[model samples]
Target: MTLQSDQKEFRSWLGTCRFSKPADNGETVFGSQAVPTECKAVVAIWADSEEQYLNVLSLRMERYGYGIIQVDDIMPAPAWMVLKARNRTGPVLARQVSAEFPFALDLIENNPISQDDNVGDDKTLKVIVTTTLHRVEPLDAQFGVFPRKTLPEALTEWFFGPATPNIFANRADTGNTDDNPSRLYAVLDAGKIPNLGELLSSSGLEYQCLFNGKTASELAEVAPYLVKLEDNNSFTRQLFSRGKEPWFLWDRAGGIFIRTAATLTELRKHLRKFTRINRGKNDWVYFRFWDGPVLNALLRGMKSKPSHVATFTQCPKTLTFITIDPLTDTANRFIIDQKRLAGAKKQPVTPAALIDTVQLETETQVSTEKRLIIEAHREALFTAPGPDDASMELLKNEIPFLKTCGISKTQYLHDVLVFLIRNDLTGGKLSPEQRDILMHKRNNAPTKIRQLEKTVSA
Candidate 1:
């Protein structure tokens, strides 16, 4: 809001606050506050490590009232994408994500572009992020994702040391488990985590976005993350301790905790493949295997519930998946199937990335199309939306009928299946013309469904 419009929210208090002259000991005071760092934002920052980055985040929020929303360390921005981005003029942050990133940076800074600046060749590149900041909000909307007030004064804050990741994780770390034999990682659903981007910025915890290489810029802000806890760092301790309030790491969004000997890099590459799967011919859909019951059923029901050790650990056989029930300390364990570890997708999980919305088919007396139909809505069938949506038996019954109706599209068959479950209708109800419309790809299936729904409602 500009002063010309006389916006009351932003009063003209330019001359109201001024910095006082430095004292004999060089203690600078501002107005009646007698301090300057209390409510301030940092301009220059040091973000070499994840821990240092956390401090940088707090300074940005406490001073500026805006918190970081999305920080992604792994976004597969190739050379071409980077070159294309360099041509643009605004908001294209030439991050340390790719080798070609430096060229773009040089162009932006108007510096002489050089090959010598092309650094960051390690396993993972430097972190670049995206965020949505808010000016101010009610305390309720701002819970669990804001920087805490510095106690006493800024003098005491610096005189001592920096704070822990969050209020819950700051205290005694009774949850530290560095000695645990199994290296643990978690797949957290970003969709369920509350204001995940803001939480990451202020808390200063490190995480990896699971959607790598495939998507445009990896869609880092909304992918399931891979949170490796073997380091036994403060982030790990914080997550374990956060079981009570804010429910940070130990959230139950159908994601699983992994126990694998594979190095973070190896496991990431291996797991990344399973994010999307062969839904149909060239059509691919996200495979959310991290969802608890879905994974539970997928592994157990699969005929081959075996662990591919060489593919997983590069040595001995050691790979197991665990699922935790929300609000409880107990957890269930299982060995995932080897068959479906061949796909990947977007937007998921908490600390550790979750992906591979996967399924397993049993040696049942069913046709190929029926299995495909079942696999298409695997998560929903396992956990139906409501009581009326419970149509496993009805769906099973209608699969063959749907096949006979020549309704090849999974979505159309699914709609017809639901209609059969809800209404007292048979294969006879669907008009031949409607079936023809649904069966043909060029025809609009939704319009036919709308007509059917209208007819039923009438």
Candidate 2:
């Protein structure tokens, strides 16, 4: 199994990252699909932005523990990923990929990335910075001192415009190509935008909240808003035009966008059909299609079942979905051409009345895929940082023992492991209280482990 982490966001990737001397920009990692756990593991450090982050970082690591790291790989993050996962993945990734810098420890602190220099980069888009270190020999020979590549111009232009291109750019109809179909609009989660409802109210742009009618009055602040943008519109221009007003869209990506020619009311009705789905429980469940990756899966589900596509999509022309996975700094534009799909367009089904048994079954299958994607990202969100190769080894051995204690939740389990690694809990003798706290049935696992996580984090 291969491990990758951007800062402390630990995850399991399906291949190896081999580090030799500085090669083609960031395309350094290589080898077979499966990595041998026993082979000497290599660590690569990166700085994702076109700023001082990398320079400041590598200088810091240069002074640590015999100063074994060399800073030479200044290639693009996409190239790095291509070489690393080339076995299983192809060149589906576009111009956007991240690179980050070397790390330091005041025993290695929080946010882990430096945010001190926020002058002109206030609205600069961010990509997660991943680094790894192992107990490999001749570490200095493997790494060399070089610059890291900046985020690609084409990808940056997608969110930001050509003259004013960015991830934080608020301008609509900026990046459309000849292949793009239908009108585009984004359903934004209000939580990410400061005073989102207020902004929408003041702006002349057409918008409708996810929770409309009665729910709109009560849960407006919490609801996601579907916004339709017009080119050069004053309200849209103001979103990212403020000097250095942090590139908010690329920062959190709190929602997803849709491409359809249907009017807002009709489009909303088409989507409302799937919002309330009946799983095995026989009760209606709210499916959050507007939030990031699930919409991608929802579109995929609609594509496979042409009947649902016909029944739901209001526009007979085409329906293309664009979702940006902030986690990977990747944006996927999933298209469903209605003209190509089989079956006649069915009448719009109200949220409550769309509950046919066969449709419900199909919806359940779609929900399952959505759930799996959500779980995988959730699992990858919180993992303990590997300080050394030995920590990783101990971590693997410690998991089975911890499972016996009922710590199965991903974050909780990792919390316990992080505590163990940091405190050398297993290497040294455990206090009776500590041992009891871990294994005791009366105290309950979550409560006990939560306290331990606090200490580890502290």
Candidate 3:
């Protein structure tokens, strides 16, 4: 049938259909006006010619919103084609005209129209439309498909699915093992822990050996003086007095512990010192909790589940490390208080932050020098010399002129070498000693530039 005839038949069928319309606007036909705010609606336009259908669809989408209708030529037909045709068919076609107001699942079951539903008087076109009183989940106008899973699984899949690469595999080796493990995992919050590995990978922090646990006797057998529990807690003090080292009481089956000469006190002291010297108050301090269950899950490549690590926060005045006794699962906490040593106040900002500023100044100086050199040697540098002897004489004369231009010997040599190389001036180039000097200057250009930057900054 013609496109005009098909459209007229569809409109006639639409007029007879009982569906809710916006009370204010009198647009009864689909794609006639702006989609009603009261309900999410999709209109499927069909014609014998794909071009005609698409043309109408584009016009409607442009007039309305792009996503108002749930059809795109890029998408697969069967995934969204709710109605199907069977056996012999002529130019006549049937398109399902269902009002899935705020899209729902039982649409087919609750739909009043059937495949057998008749279109009055029009044999060439049939539009079987059904309107449901009940509202389904809100339709994503852009993507009409409703989520098949529950909210949590949907959210989990959305976040850690194929898009986010598994980053737990990138963790720095902590020498953890079944026998002589070198790390402990502690669970902080189960919910916020899933993306901790990604967070750490992006933070650009250098990995350091932070803590170690070993029996006092075992430590004594190796280096006893290095292992000391300097925790201010009374319980820890009492445990130490009783010669109860943390590793001695460790339950092999319950929790993992590392055996090393490194002490927690040393780690804390190092961090405190580093922060005092390098980090400002505005800089962030990150924390990671290594709990057994969460660690196992991460190692097993299960990123969808919650991780044991906590989110990084601003550095606190004091950091509390909690150790769970494997035997009783009771917590033994030790606080690392940030000590304000005498000369640890904020100092004058250094040149490290001014690297960009110094770089800009260096670039400007180099540009100015290049301009001066180009102007001074425009004729000798650019023009072809009379002969080999004349070119050699010109190069020899320019050497003194180059040095007097306030350019460093290294820079002068570099510029001269570049000019010679570009101009093919090397018939039997400089002597080995001169070549070596040029090579040295070329290699040390970066260092020279750095020194120049320092001088300028100072």
lDDT of 2 by residue, 72-102 (tens): 2223344445445532221222221123313
Each prediction's RMSD to truth: 25.2, 18.6, 30.1
- Weakest 10 consecutive residues, lDDT, candidate 2? 133-142
Q: How would you encode candidate 3's per-residue C-alpha lDDT over 129-234 as one tens digit per residue?
A: 1111111121122135344222122122121222211111111221112211132212222122233233223433222223235532332222111122222322
Score residue 31 of candidate 2 by CA lDDT: 29
Best prediction by TM-score: 2
Q: Residue-wise lDDT of candidate 1 within 1-458, one digit each (tens)?
A: 01123322221000001111112323223222223221221121223322333443344333433222213221122322332353332223323212221111111121221345333221111111211111111112224744532211211211123322321111122122221224566676666666555555555444566785666145545567776653324444334333345733543342576665556666676677666765546576677666655555454442221122113322222345665433223344443212122221222222122312233333223433444434434433453222222343545666775566456577766666555445545435566654564465444546656756776686
Better of 2 and 3 by lDDT: 2
Predict model 2's lDDT versus the native: 0.44
TM-score of candidate 2 to 2 decimals: 0.46
Error of 1 at 108 (Å): 72
Identify the candidate with maximal lDDT: 2
* CA lDDT for candidate 1: 0.39
